[model samples]
Target: MESSCPSTPRWNLDRPFLTGRFHQEIKGTSRFASDAKGCPLDSFSSGLENPIGCYDGAVQELIVIDDLLFALVGIEGRYISIKRVHGKADVFSFQVDASMDLALQEIAKRIFPLCESFLLIDEFVESGSQFKNGLVNHALAAALWALLLDYQAMVAQLEHQFRLRRLSIQGLWFCYQPMMGSMQALSTVIKKVSANNYAGSAVLNLLQSQAKAMAGDCAVRSLLEKMTHSASIAYLSILERVISWFILWI
Candidate 1:
């Protein structure tokens, strides 16, 4: 999506949040929402109206992926047919609407970190457990696949946009910063995947290769600390929405 203001910066792979239409679709007719027992849909959506939280240091950062997985598993179970959910979440439906290419990408981004985090510390998603096997591993693999597809599209768009003319130094930084942030997110997941010897190695490797191929000689080698600074506030808002959907879907 293009920014209305010419001076406003645009990100290559901006994060996703629910559009009003998506929220309406799910809340109105989704079997997942209706079948979810005791878990009120409001728990997820209440914050969407005005999402803001202050940090008082009550919550300590999780030191290990196992801890995160433990938290993830604590969600109450309902028998989700993995095949059915996968069919629903496949590439065609991910866009939410014609204009929102990044919608599913953002969801995948939020999910991959959790997936890698869990896989890294547990060392493997035990094949026998329903939660790990059906929800975590299966869902993670699906999300990564969707993300890889989106990333490839982004590479093509970026190549075409930048090929005709070189941007000014400031313009270049604005353009590349979001690209680097996306790479950092991918790199973190890849490291965890490599460490764990996870099942989705093929997908991860392909994603890494695509990123490398797309980056070429551009200065994407170094991590930029402030790459996401401008979007942090909006990121938090999107994150609040993601958490809501996570509870609803899981």
Candidate 2:
């Protein structure tokens, strides 16, 4: 036994060395401990526990419609704006559901033609050199100008109601829907006259034609008739003067 090599020390299974230290290190660095500290498990549990509440909050936030009606009519407002490029006014600065957006765009298409027609007539009149005797054209321009003012007043009233919280998006859309046909008809007549360079009697004749084409019971038909009569007054007066002079000469 004295000649034997030095004996190797054996690890004791019942009392392992540094067992507490190893456990402490593993506890600090374990995957479960890291995940808990990083809040991944807490977030997963919370999401599973109250997903419906989160969804409801999101829906509530999204349901508040803003500036949709004003934008449709090309008015600049809190949530929407307009940009003019190359004489074309374009709406931007807001977004909504696809179907709603499309509907607004369609309404805008009807509204803008009237606006453009008004501008075109205004510019034509203001140019001052385009007409030799512009009394009739001036009368037509004045009539269109008055009509535009009335339309704008109605829009302002609606905007006031909306601002006071008395009108909902659906209600506004319903209120505006009936005006589309009238606006389109007026735009058509104005565009036709404009395209023809507003020749003599063009505006009055087109207005009469459009009025006749409309339903007899229609309010816009009556309006067009009134405008035609008003616009023709100056032309009629001029014709009367010419006839009187011719009779005196004869």
TM-score of each model, in listed order? 0.24, 0.56
Model-by-model lDDT, in order?
Answer: 0.31, 0.49
Q: After best superposition, candidate 1 residue 92: deviation in angstroms?
A: 33
The prediction achieving the highest TM-score against the true structure is 2
Estimate, for each residue in 1-250, the C-alpha lDDT of model 1 and write its tens digit.
Answer: 1143233123311321211011112213232212223333233323333211121212111111112222222211111110112332211111111111233223323433333233222222222122323233444444444544554464345445445533222342344345544544544544554456443334334444544654643443221122222223334555678899999999
Which residue pairs collide, candidate 2?
none
Backbone clashes for every candidate come to 0, 0
lDDT of 1: 0.31
Off by over 4 Å in 1: 1-135, 166-173, 198-250
Model 2 C-alpha RMSD to native = 31.7
Cα lDDT tens digits, model 2, 87-148, are: 22211122222222334434434444444343344333333122432566667667766766
